[model samples]
Target: MAAAKEGRKAPSRKSAAEEQLPGIEDARTAFAPALSGALERPRSMLRALRFRPPQLLHLEGGEAADRVALALWWAALLNCDDPEVMEPRASAMGPCLSCSSCLRLGVNMHPDLILLDGREGSIKIDDVRGLRSILGEKPHFSRWRVIIAAEAQALGIEAANSLLKVLEDPCPDTCFVFTAPQRERLLPTLVSRGWVVTLPWPEAGRPLAEELRPWEQALGRFVSEGRGWLDMTAARNGMDAAKAHQILLIGQKALADCLAGREGGMLAAVFRRMPAQALMQVDELFVECQDQLQAQVSPLLVLDSMAARLHILARR
Candidate 1:
């Protein structure tokens, strides 16, 4: 299930197209050479879609949301019953997003679209165990099965090895797509199995408070003041930790960028107001909170603890 149904009501949803990063529009141009060669052969359109591209496709760069949106778009394209709506609409149409098949993809409920996320920031061995059985069956609706691993770098040692086994002997009708901050961060074994496409984060330059959602800006203020504002309301509002995690990572990166004398991202000023030691401690605490949540800690309790911890971190 997507974050919404996981009882962690996500703050907002960014559809695949809405999440496109800087170079997404020029997508085919980047893959033009390979696409040209692939199209040179006069194969049936269905055959081309199902069996043409390499089974493994890695989407590199951009924020996690951007990558996810891209992955979803790719998955939708692969399974769209009507290929006429694709790339070259006149030549190859993209998915009619309104169709039943496409709708399922939008909702993250397509039987053939398997979404594997790192529950607590790590993709453990058990997470990969079910892939085998899921792949064993034929796709329930679409012509091809698509498996998207949102944060491929989060795969643990054993999980990566397990994934490698399947890659070594992949199911013919399935496509494996991975999204990550950097391709180099992935296991070499995984990297060697596929080509990579890099998507840099969208050009970022905004005040930290402005970069975040209005609520996040408010949260930042509360954090800066060593106050508790997100204790109960976040859960009531269905906040998704993944989104928070992204912000935390961005904030940390901003701090690093500031340190290196580079123009930092939106949250740079926020970090500027924070002490280095306190920021480090807060970062570590967030990781711990995520891990505990994965370990079945009560959501309310976990959040309360986070609020208390943030208050202390801010005080320092």
Candidate 2:
């Protein structure tokens, strides 16, 4: 993506027509419960700002769209002029959607809200430098300047390091928010600098597939019945990187479902028998496999490696 132009307001990546379309407003109602739950930490931090507040906030584990919406909601709350009017019980409960700050943020026009979107392309070093320049100035219209880097996993290494420098010595009254499929997708050093808020996986949008049954059953047996059931050769044959990644995701969802106590599936039944720590290890393995895939590792090698490691876990 191109670097944001220098000014109080970084030029919006969205076209005028796209900005006019309903976004965070619709997301607020559609994802009310999830948004409310995710906002609790940031809300508390905002209430205790006299103490050290996290300069960087990582919103992880949700649909990318939902993460962005939650970030926007948090931004609104931070800048809202009348949060007390909407949330009478607690002044910091949430944003008053009608406040001037909230209104501009709702439509992505807030000058203090700078968005460095990496969804369409890699966020480059120039983008981070441009953002640094803008952040050097004070908030143009609100108590806080919020920078939302949506799909931050797409930030190139150089750009991520550049942003990391900003995070290390963050501008006063500035907050940096990052949204990603998982915090593991970001550099560990970068993730360490932020406060991570994990959003629940949206129930209706969790990836599902009828074709996943066979794979799920296979995984269940491999875990339940031991290494004899794992056929790495067969698993690797004819599989491409995309399909391998899908299988890992499917496995992850099953493990997550089992942990959440959502019942009645083959994988869930098998996963439920394992200790919670073992289940977590399996999930971490899936993430590691995904990282390898993203690094252009061969699908066969990744699958075979995953199978061997899973078999060792199954034995435990």
Best by lDDT: 2
Residue 50 CA displacement from its true place in model 1, Å: 7.2
Q: Model 2, 79-117: lDDT tens per residue?
A: 676635233356446666665567677667777888887
TM-score of 1: 0.57
lDDT of 2: 0.69
Candidate 2, superposed: residue stretches over 4 Å from native:
1-52, 83-92, 201-289, 292-316
Mind giving the per-residue lDDT tens digits that candidate 1 earns over 1-316? 0111111111233456534333322433322322323223321232234325567778776555566666676676666655454433334444455555566676566667888885335677888998888777766656667888877766767788899999888575688888777776577889889767666544544434444554444455565664445643454555444444454454455556555566664344555667778767766876686555444344456655765666666566
After superposition, the stretches of candidate 1 with alpha carbons farther than 4 Å from their true spots are 1-51, 83-92, 119-121, 206-248, 259-316
Worst 10 residues of 2 by lDDT: 1-10
Q: Write out the backbone clash pairs for model 1.
A: 9-238, 84-93, 85-93, 85-94, 86-93, 86-94, 208-266
